[model samples]
Target: MKRRKFIGLLGGAAASWPLAARAQQTRMPAIGFLRSSSSAPSQFLATALREGLKEQGFVEGQNVQIEYRYAEDEKERLRNLATDLLARPLAVIVADTIAAIQIKAAATTVPLIFASGGDPVAAGLVTSLNRPGGNVTGVVFFATLLGAKRLELLRRAVPNAAMIGVLTSRTSPNVEAERGDIEAAALALGQQLTVVDVNGEDEFDTAFVTFIRSGARALLIGSGTLLTTNRARIIALAARHALPAVYPHREGALDGGMMSYGASVADAYRQAGIYAGRILKGEKAADLPVMRSSKFEFVLNLRTTKALGIDIPPTLLALTDEVIE
Candidate 1:
């Protein structure tokens, strides 16, 4: 070959090398993060998920890529968002309970890791907790089943209240289960319960009004993405009414709700992230048993309690995992 041709060939190869490297970087494995709620309220959960991914040596934007889709609490948008994610070449999908249900309905073949507060079996997300024999498996925090526990705690905070109001979401997958649990507990405790369901923020005022009219002296906020997303508004309403309310997640107490009892939502998300990382590393979702989150936190906000002129029972305080002063 001519000397000039050889030099030109080398120059072309060097230029192509950078393009090749860029192409390779762009081809990094991607995972989809889908949620049925708004992003701002659940930012901490997302951070926890990233931390878990990091634990498995997968960092977003470095070795793995994450594509996020949020429905902003609109149930109708979930299927569309999921369909969009499914169109991509995703190694796995990490989604909240409702979003996971919708994705499965879409007949997606990709591995799915769900962070759910409800019963995965009841919701048909999986076959069983011990063996989730499908392309879907994830973390269950049992937030739905904790209604009875929350009711017991709420009664401790307001022992003499003739009626306790329960606020739940109509759209929640766990609504029926949570209602049954709370009702059974209420009956067992000889507590009169007035349960109200709201589908959106617009219906909150009506729900509160119903509770007030029903002579509900205390409140128990139920588990659901919608309820968790609109916690601030519900907290304000409870405060305005001077009602002592118990919430399902720690964030509620952190944001000024009187108290909260349930599993650590952030931890559940982290567990789902870990599962997603493992799936990316060639583990089948079917082979990985559904993980039940073991970390449960009962947070009591002394400030909120004091503001409402409510006293926390000594026995209940003893059982608290955290006291936010």
Candidate 2:
């Protein structure tokens, strides 16, 4: 009887040991990263996000596992990718664009941390930026506001231009939604707006030709991951057309666009990263307040302006965060 009792006790202890070990093994959260742009690993933006995560004590490989998926400009790929990622028990899903919309369409149960270029409310990603009612929340760029500011800066840079061409990707995720904002800015500046729409990577030349024929004296390049990816072609086209152009990214200005004014992308990435870290640390997405960019950066290229015979105003020069002489 004693030997039988000992064997029963030993069996019970063995059964409970695995459960105890699992309970104490330090649960590592999983982060699912999905983006519309190329996963520019070398970008300081990626580093900033990691730094923010580290600040929350979430080590990428040790304490947390990050499953990175890049669509690299293919919208359809995000849908399929989201479906596959759903199989994993992700702690948080960082959906960084219209890609978020796609991810949500596929997986509604998983909490989503989205970083979007347009109004979150309008995109149907969340109920409100402050209190995103469902299992989704993150950040907004308020791209419309950014567009208006970019136009304001462009007008300051080229005060004499009467006709302004706004170049946008026709297939951009939020192109239709952003038209009104750009239109309003054009009216405010009292400049004739020639909205040039390019639908594909190969359509830039056709659009620039149309801009010239349409009597555009200057250009306003829309902010989109797609357009920025083809920065070299865009810059070359602007130069070939001899049009003074403003872009939404500093990289564009650095590549010789006349000017740029928009959210500090790296700053937004860091902010998003912090939110991801919080989620990884067990913070609910709905409770984590989504933040808009606090600052916009202005970059000016004097050489590009000179090529187009546009002399930037002193007032504009004074406001620039960076100027390439």
- Lowest-sum lDDT 10-residue window in model 1: 104-113
lDDT of 2 by residue, 1-325 (tens): 9999999999999999999999768667888877665666325555666777887887788888788887776767867778878889888787666678888777767888776667777778888878887788887765545777777777777677688888887656678767778898778767788897786678888889889998887889886666866777899998998888888767788888888887766666677778888876677888887888877778889888787777777877889899898
Off by over 4 Å in 2: 1-27, 40-44, 307-309
Tens-digit lDDT track for model 1 on 38-89? Answer: 9888788889999989989999999898898899878678878988999998
Colliding residue pairs in candidate 2? none
Error of 1 at 134 (Å): 2.0
lDDT assessment of candidate 1: 0.91
Q: Which prediction has the highest TM-score against the true structure?
A: 1
